[model samples]
Target: MIVRPRPNWFRMLLVVRGSVLPAILPQLLITLAFALLVTLLHGRVFVWKVSLTFVPFSLIGLTLAIFLGFRNNTSYARYWEARVLWGEVLNDTRSLARQALTLVDGPAPSRIFVHQLIAFVHALRHQLRGTDPAADLDTWLSDEARQRLQGARYKPSAILLMAGEWLRERRRQGELAAPLVQAMEVHMGHLSDALGGCERIAGTPIPFTYAVIIHRTVYLYCLLLPFGLVDSIGSMTPLIVTFIAYTFFALEALSSEIEEPFGTEPNDLPLDAMCEGIQATLLELLGERDLPAAPKPVNYVLS
Candidate 1:
């Protein structure tokens, strides 16, 4: 997220701030310490004597390493894909809002529909964050809309359906003709797909058992890596082990963090900011005052 690279190492280090060590830092510390101790005592004091021929442990560890690499790679792909899909959703939501305001015929319900569209954005942010929208939805929602959402199991979807029903009613009253109404339906469908896509990503996560397996394998690999290298590497085992552990651990940590890129985390997708952008665009069409302002991230971090 650090754009415009600073030449100074100190500045760059500060830029990377809390991206440093994770909760698994303790494991890294243990791995490095064990590696140094074994390497120092490798030939001088003892040998683990684990090998593919004499001991089967070495081959097992090697196989685990290959599995670790592949697991991390696949998880990273999922993480990246989730972000990309959300980005598309963000764009499409803006487009839907624009169409809803401009194309829909106006007055009471249509004007209310424009506001509800904005409320839906925040509702979606709440849905993604797994929180109630009661705190923030007041600005965009009317009393009737809020009352409808009171016990709704899925608030965002409910709000969306309201928009659809409103559209149908308008068409019924001859407020919108077939072509314009059909065009509005298409945009509404796009919003529906976007909502469904995000819901799918949230509802169906990577299998828990596979995650547990990958975590256990990474731990086992680090544990055995020291023993394998210590006999040959000597005192320098600490540095080598740390470097290797850092690379693997970093990848694992990154994949996990980004897998659900819709939170308060530094790299979380800019859903709130994106929603505000949609609000602004739609408000321009409604010519509404008290418009929502974009939430600019502090130090390039948007939550």
Candidate 2:
């Protein structure tokens, strides 16, 4: 989700202040210390000459790089696809709100029902993040509806089903004609599809064995890199290998962090904030005096 160009080295040092650093720092120091030890122990015996690569190191490094790249790329694609699907949800929610304002008669319970629909959006958002849904619902929902969702699992889907039932009932009564009810139900169906799409992404993940293999290979590369370079590169082996190792491991960690953007990480996708957009879009149609502000972005990132 980070849209900025890859930072230069100076900025990168600052930007890596998150999870990647902790994983990299230890490997770097270990490489450095061992590099120094080799220089002290073999400084006199080996010439100043240095050889950069052993055939196997190059092969192994390339293999790891290609495989890791493939994994990360696939993961990012899945993450971005999820984002696009959620964007559709936002657009469809707006469409639903527009349809509600135009089709439903403006009267007694109309304002209340429409506002409750907005509450359902917020409720769905909080539910997805495993956050408490009880408080966000009260302002938009009837006491009974709020109670139904408060302790329940699948909060968003529950509210959605309620909305569907409301439409069905209106159709049964003389209030809303069958055609209008069907049109509204179509939007409701989109809501259901969005929920299903999100659930699929959340449930499915890259195989654990694949992730484990990638991790183990990265560590092994870092560990064995010194042996390949120490004899020829001498004192420089540690620093050089560590630098190279840092690049490999850092990319690996970053990709894994963003692999499931819905996850609760500083770098994860901003579902809560997207849900806020839904609220603003719906509430504005109701022409309420006061509307809640949209969810604010963090330092630079949204959600």
Candidate 3:
């Protein structure tokens, strides 16, 4: 995601990062050109009085705006829910690390738990983004663990299962006491819930019917607008149509970008940086040196 300070008004007008202007530029230009042609035709083409009034357009515009607002809100809710789920990931991982460090009797076993926790973060990030996690997981997991994860359908859940099994093994070996094992199990459940939540969001999306209806409505409104404005706005029809088209089209584009919330879009969540942060925190808890550096934003964008 773009991670810069807010720009001043003048600079903000020209800012492109995290903005949908680029994606909608073609649509805006086309609408402007159409409006220009309509204006030159003087609301008539080839002896045809092709004209429309502003009244119906105005009423439709109001309802269209409301629908756009609703769609945007729905998209933002998905985005925010994704953020919240990742927040839970960070919290639960930290909590698990703390429990393992304090309750587990041996540093060797505790370090294994920490490595698994860190690997789980990377695994979840890779799973959500649909990227290969072999490189990320190889360093933290043993050859056997890594091989077992290879070709696994749900790698993050597979990693979490390993972690839980490790905890159960330790408990059986009398390394972790019953009460503290129970505590760790609770945190493990939180991790499981977070994984399930992210998967649910990634799999499910805003209804297709709503998306189709809103998409057609926005395009129809933008295309029909020039007909309504050319006779009334006269020479200024192009500018007005382009501005309105930009507003409507940009919103639609942004909603589509954020609705998924896991892709590598400029506005999508920074899963890489988040996973790195989790790794750093968990490794520090395990007193490991030579920790990987936290991810830094490039060109004011983090991912």
Best by lDDT: 3
User: Per-residue alpha-carbon lDDT of model 1 for 258-286, expressed as tens digits?
Assistant: 66766667655777677777777777766
Error of 3 at 262 (Å): 0.7
Model 1 clashing residue pairs (backbone):
none
Quote the positional error of residue 240 for candidate 1 in Å: 0.6
The segments of candidate 1 whose C-alpha lies over 4 angstroms from its true place after superposition are 1-15, 18-23, 43-70, 107-109, 288-293
Q: Tens-digit lDDT track for model 2 on 1-303? A: 333456789888688534477766876787667666655655333655333356789999899999989998988887887888778777777776777667766544456656666776776667566677777787778888876776677877888877777767666766778888788778788878878887777778888899999999998787667767777676787788778888888788878887777876767887777777777767777776487776665555566
TM-score of decoy 2: 0.85
* Steric clashes per prediction: 0, 0, 0
RMSD (CA, Å), candidate 3 to true, equals: 1.2
Ranking by lDDT: 3, 2, 1
Write down the RMSD of all candidates, one decimal each.
3.6, 3.9, 1.2
What's the TM for model 1? 0.83
For model 1 the local lDDT of residue 280 reads 79
Looking at candidate 1, the ten consecutive residues that score lowest on lDDT are: 45-54
- Span of ten consecutive residues with least summed lDDT in model 2: 43-52
lDDT for each candidate structure: 0.70, 0.73, 0.89
Better of 2 and 3 by TM-score: 3
Q: Which candidate leads the pack in TM-score?
A: 3
